[model samples]
Target: MNTSIFSRFQTRSHGGITLRASAFAAILCAALHAHAAQDIYFNENTSVSSPNRYLNESSNWYTDAGRTQQFEGTLSSDYNGIINTESKISASCASELSLNSLTYNIAAAKDYNNYFASLADNASITLAEDFNVNITFTPETGWNIQTIRMFHNGRITVGGDFNLTFDKNGSGSNGFLEFVIRNDSASAALTNRFQVAGDFNYTAVESGSRLRFVTGIGQFFVGGAMDIGNILWTINNPSSSEGANISLGGLTGTSGMISLGTGMASTMTFTNSAQREAKTTIGYTGDETTLNVTMRASDAKNGYQILRISSGAYGATDANLGDVIIDTGRLDLGMHSGMKGNYLSIAGVDGVFSATASDSGNIGAATFENGEWYAGKIAIDIEGELAYDKIVFNGRFEKTGSDRDMGFEFAFDAYTMRELISAGRGEFILEDVITYETGSSMAGTVFEGNTSGIQWEAVFGDTSLSVSFTVPEPAAVAAVLGAISLAFAALRRGKRA
Candidate 1:
């Protein structure tokens, strides 16, 4: 599993972009990497490339250091390794070294680059257990992606799972390809896991040439479970920590753009609420930070709302931002407020958060977030049309926070319901999604069910509704539940015929 013949001289980069080639793509890198099949290189003109050289010695492994090309051990996936030398050796890189795709160049030797050996300057590596690398790319141009660059006082300790995978076909302009990690791990706090997880089946191509997944300082810790096709593209984490520890559980995705954050300090957390595939936007930034999301407004996904959170275009601020507890969700069509917070809770039991800022392209002022909400456990501000008792969300829910309540009930029926405003100053309604499609059917009320066996009224008029009643106590649809309207049936005319 160890072989030789990879000596091409270098300069490359990924995700953050930097792979300068044009001498005809560096003369098509030996015809797109044919560096003699089982190619391996890390001889950096020997001298041991520096310090303790002996990665299971094959003459200290070479492609050129006057050792006349070498390679006698370590590498699988039919071999093709290249680490244009940064020299430093640690024992058993997966049983004395392994690679199928490891190209972290320090000097271009024609980008068939490879290596995982990340230990910069104050270098350090202790692989006591696992260390697999089916992928990692920093050798660009001939884009067959692979990279592993963890600088600034680098250090690694993998007791298990450093598994890799990212083989995106980069196109013209040499169509970029990447799998980056500028991680600053000194064990960033212990036990390595960094698993990028399975199902990279690929197919989200729009390739104007810029495939991505960038990272830098979220410190490591992910053995698996990063679902949603494992965040395949466009994940830009612009470094910033001090108290920027990371943990994200139960995430669903269509996450087209996730920007992470800026100068973090307070804290960051997301334990639930994530179901995207319709205009996805999950952003974050500085200040007080307190994110907690649980879902149970019947977990909407098809009736409307998989996810919607916006600090607007990603600059977040109430002078820095924080606080988003949505017990269940909705919003995000337009009119965003860059999320300046002080409050936006809408939590549990009957918690149903929905905001439809005038539908039709939602031009403005809807998911308004500049913070002014102060409701807890009870907020029922029904302002028209929101059905999903299992599929019915014709859009329309606008909440601005702060109402005062302990109870509110309104079962809704749809087909264009009209008018209903039960403003909860103490915040009411935790168990009724929305009922008001907006006027006319003459305002409905004409049920002649079996008035004589042949009757049907409500072509679009009386569709069936129930903002029912109960806001602490206001009964009389027959004392609360006797009759809530919208009824039909009872046909028997066979005997007369």
Candidate 2:
């Protein structure tokens, strides 16, 4: 054999072969280093203030000035910074946005109220809990809660139907009061409804308590038991679509005052010809969805014009109303007979043609014009293609034609949107957003964002408007990829050497 060939085949006694293997490994690692530099990792806690950094660069996308109504972007923040959970966005006259998912640490004993209250805007807020979450809203006469899972202990006087549900926390031992409308008194005009679900025990908090259930009108003297799993009750009023539908499963504990109708009548009417209108629908069934509406109606001969339609708390006047109205075809209700009263209605609409999947908060194209009023009939469509089993809403309350001269202006006060998506615990997503007064009431010229009837026009002219979103921190993704590459390279080199 040739001397050189023999040398090539000869094993180096000084571990030359091992040295060669090491060099090859080193070269492989160097090549991996070049590739691994591209990997990235995204942190939810990463604070990004600039729109360009979190949006424009790789996440946010927007349209031109002529189309400023359209935009899409993704944001990252601690879970508590956004919504309480996987809740839907609250839509009002003003449009808003929210972060759907977030990451952060949560201790079981921490108060989540601050986090939840912080996100109250005209947008959807969601929080991902890392530990047992406990929240208290405190106790207030209007709206307050001291402890969740427990109803207020005092004589809770509710003018309107009060509904409460405490899942795992409510064990049947507790007691609560329920008030419903009764017609026994000829002067008492029956309006409003009440219902509760679950394997819960309900007691009459008051002896002379006027109560009405799915059955009929009667004074509730003792507590009642409800087991929605096998029994369901629906208090329906043939005169109006206002009633209670209660359904639930499992043991539930509740105690407190259950007041029926708007708690006070001084500012309201409760008699038959008393010009009274109040309704509530509360259900404990994990799946039983209910709709409620309260309107102030007058005798038909008085020229009935709708003043407001709201999901919650239709304020004193219509001039500065803030409610969510669906974007559908023009709201044209030719000619109807009724008196001067505020009306609010809710129904289902076409989900596919109306909204895109994965999208939550929505706006519509209804405009104000002519002496006649047009209002969108709202709906939460669950019929077909847009079959995410999601919720959709369209609300309209208008007064035009001759009734435009009504003195009081519309004022929309409170708005909220809540939904329970998770299967366990009180793992619900709730959006409670409110908009500050615009400093101006519904008045002035028709096209200047107001109509003769103080109608609120679209903030953005074109109704074909929507908000799009994108994922931020593309670098983080690159970091993760690079780390993965480095790990693989290390393993490869270790095996090769």
Candidate 3:
């Protein structure tokens, strides 16, 4: 019963004690006044006149527990002004960070390391109109992100370099970092672009990450080593209407691979307007790889050569060129200019050169107008009987080396020695004959005359003879006849005596 008037409140009955209404209203007004002091609101089209507006009002953004801060309410900037901030400015909206026409310029030479760690998946940052802003996203160590999409509508000409570094968290893959340049304006004549005057370096540490450059109408020229898993170009409108091109400028001094298309069936056309050769090497680290080339230019009369072994790596097992099995897999070289003379040449340094056809395939079929077939050693081993349409040796068809007693068998349809006897070009001298059999009869098979001391006979039915005679001239024949008549007269006179 010693409570004071300030501590207790008297009700209408005075038996029950309750807090006074005026005191409760006073406490609520104080709480509301405190919250109103912390809350910052800006009307539509509110402009920031000074460049250091963010640094001037740092207390409004420093309420977060960590170095990262998130703007809680809907904040939009529609004025054409510049915001220079070293700290991170995250304008949160329901769907997009719609900077209507605000140019948010980051401070030069400052590393924004892990400042943009709070960007969510559904949140997209869009820079519209002539809002030329340059921002660098340099991740700190152990920074693993999912994706960060930046869509610029107008022009973003970064005066200095915008360096981006993606550090690998662990063995997992890093997410994509995409920059989209789109012309979101209604006017078709307006062209939006994003240009970097200084060097833009994007360094990736891991192998499973990708960097994509998407554009509706723009051109990207990357200079240095864009070391990512892949540099993807997603040209939305890739036609001539709104053409987009990404020039790599001949990736000099960089040792990496660039994957052109996304999937398996994607076709990438490589065309060279010049007359020089566009040569490409398809190499693999694995054991087996196949290269399929379908040349559809039937109208091209210029011959192209596919040299198989320009150089050789000779091994013990792979000592000869024949060891390399050139599998012409479904090759159809249809009547091209390459099918002319000297179509194929197989040459090697050492060992015998041989060509083989499989049981299922034919080696080739060609017609030679006038060409000599020369072989150092010709060995033909037929599995079955052999037949030739015609065998004509225009030159001397004689074995020139030492004659051995190997014993050979040769069957001919019709043997002729007329040219040898008449033209006196070559002599057919049979050294030895084991057995001789002819299909003709033996009535006058043997020759009865000699011509130029070279006599040849068509002997039939196992007859052998060793006779030599010299062909008499016209004067020699008359002298021989007169001598024979004189001898006959002398014999008759002797008998009468």
Candidate 4:
């Protein structure tokens, strides 16, 4: 550990100088090794373009329906045992009842003695049917009939139907009468008394199913499996903090925008999905139009952007944040091993790599390192082998603004009809075969392998692929050390003299 040995040795002219230069060279080599071990670099000139801005857009949208309702206190009367019931009760459920059945008092006049009363107790009572009768409670005051109690049930279930009412007319003095329908077989019973109030929510699923309340405040439409309660639709009521919230299951096949708010300005959730063929268009009222064309999930796995148009064929301006547009071309999923082409393409997206593939385009496995960043992972099928390639992150540095437009692209080879049929194992399967004319000499085949001589070009724009760095070269560094050593030797010799 004699640090001065090297310095003092430098003072020795001939032999010592050579040894000092050699030591300095060793230090320079070590520094070079350290610099070479870095991963990821940022090129300031280019930026990572947002992955095909339409990655989530599609042609068709999966849908589920629901409904909800709220009622306020209201007063109405039931006369002649006739209840005016509303028709067409859709998927509507009430939480509580404020007002159930109504009560009334009637009087029988004159001498209406021998009489009978009728009562109809049904779940739904209609005013079209009527019943009337009267009874006498007289001779005591030598006057007219005073009052009779009229009772009605809100929640009623009936096995049969009958008329319910009270009447008096035959004789002079009025008679006391009341209609009573037993809840034994076919009649309504008494239940809670509550009125339906507030707003009602309704959501459509398979097709056209609607629930009409007084006024609808909000509704929700989820695209996948879910558990629903009495309330069909729900909206995220951030203000109240107790209302319903909508959940999106997965990407659908069409483009759609969910809007929340009143008047012109509103918040929106845009989505789309495609099956065989579809068209999805989305945009704000004042924004530019954008459309993405894609294939079904089945097609995507088979190495085909079924739609001549692919996702991200369009650009994203400030107006396209929650807006998605897509169009699904044809059902040209070749008939081979249930193989269908996929048109969904993603570029310049950073995060965990999650993809599953089959056929020759299957991704066997992938490795993530250096912060576990998979720069670009593309799956394509060649012949019968699934080929997956992920660019390893060499290195990275500080960044500002948007992500760079970094991605990989592959060109496919053309195949003849005969080759496609034979390659698909007797199933007509073609990969990346477009009927339209194109610049590339690639041919189209219903069932065949991808084109040859295809090279993937990594697109780097706005940002540098490698981080900005400059390590001093060994020659330059050694020269600096040599000069320092010379200076030190002269100073030491001068002191010694």
Over 1-497, each residue of candidate 3 has an lDDT whose tens digit, in order, gives: 66754455554434564557666677778987654423222211112233222321222332232324533444333322244454244332223443334344333212222222122223333433333434433333122222122223333333334455443334243234454444433423124333433344555556654455444434343322222224443434323233334422111111222222211111111111111111111122222222122211112222121212111111111111101111111111111111112111111111111221211121212111111212121111111112211111112122222222111122222223333223334434332121122221221223333333333332322322112222345687778679989999999999999
TM-score of 2: 0.19
Q: Which candidate gets the maximum TM-score versus the true structure? A: 1
Listed per candidate, the RMSD to the true structure in angstroms reads 21.1, 28.7, 35.8, 32.6
Q: Rate the local accuracy (lDDT) of all candidates.
A: 0.35, 0.22, 0.29, 0.23
TM-score of every prediction relative to native? 0.27, 0.19, 0.25, 0.22
Tens-digit lDDT string for candidate 1 (174-284): 534455554534434222223322211222333343334544544433322233333433222324334333333333444333444345432323332343323334454
Best by lDDT: 1
Of candidates 4 and 2, the better by lDDT: 4
On TM-score, the stronger of 1 and 2 is 1
**TM-score of decoy 3:** 0.25
With candidate 4 superimposed using the best TM-score fit, by how many Å does residue 120's alpha carbon deviate from the native?
30
TM-score of 1: 0.27
In candidate 2, where is summed lDDT lowest over 10 consecutive residues?
A: 148-157
Instruction: Please give the ranking of all candidate structures by TM-score, highest first, separated by commas.
Output: 1, 3, 4, 2
Report the C-alpha displacement of residue 9, candidate 1, in angstroms.
Answer: 58
